[model samples]
Target: MNERRTAVPPLIVTQDNSFFFEGAAAGRLLIQRCADCGTLRHPPGPTCPQCRSFEWDTVESSRRGTLHSWTISHHPQDPAFEYPLAVGLLDLEEGTRLVADIAGVPHDELHIGMPLEVGFAEHAHGAVLPQLRAPGASRTEEGES
Candidate 1:
């Protein structure tokens, strides 16, 4: 049987949120945090959602979290979604929740409150997308070099 190997996607350079693209490309998961209230925020906004303060900082999470919620998507929303994808929300250890694609596992095996880790999906367009995986899960043989 052949295994599926994942690749790194190209990056899209933009002015404000370019760091997100770069971080995904490098396999690092990054999110914005409010320096004032120490609240974690996703989508990289300029202001803190909790304190509504402009003081913010870039933070890298451990990429480990629990599955908050999820859904299996068989329909392709875009041409890039060629395979069956699991879209999920991860509740990070830092009290932040992030929306990402869950990979490296079958959709039936996914469960709420399951431990998850972060990974990067390399797209052909050079833009990397963040993905979630079961704890200690590895790619298939096709994914290996």
Candidate 2:
């Protein structure tokens, strides 16, 4: 009999931006929201700059957004990444813009304002990185290849 081994999942840690990791593992996309004025924030800060409110809350994002900007890298910045990878800024429905890799779509098909959803990619080192893709797109067995 042959035995197959399953790799352990990545460990996500959060020293300051614990909300981001906490939400990811739970399959919920979360961003920082101001408790005082209800403004959404990215990069998860300790305070709301607009309202000067120290009180903040973590809210589940729509997991849906539009492509704000994008770039294709022919040269790999990190050796682990394959050539011709696309990275982009996704503007979430919650009003926060997130920067992550735009995957599972051809670069020629990318356009600003195209609706997208969140996806997760597990690295060789076992770290899970957030990725963006076209709406209704799936990483496996569906959508544009």
Each model's TM-score, in the order given?
Answer: 0.77, 0.79
Candidate 1 lDDT, 4-106, residue by residue in tens: 3435244446555777778877777888778899887777777787788988777898889999999878754455555577889999987788888887777
lDDT score of residue 5 within candidate 2: 39
Q: What tens-digit string does per-residue lDDT give for candidate 2 at 1-145? A: 1222335234445554887876765556888888999888888777788988989888887789999999998853554565688999998887889998887788899999999998766554545557897776644523444
> How many backbone clashes are present in model 1?
12
Choose the strongest candidate by lDDT: 2
Off by over 4 Å in 2: 1-15, 123-125, 139-145
Each model's lDDT: 0.75, 0.76
Candidate 2 has a TM-score of 0.79
Cα misplacement distance, residue 119 of candidate 2 (Å): 1.4
Local lDDT at 139 for model 1: 43
Could you tell me which residue pairs clash in candidate 2?
Answer: none
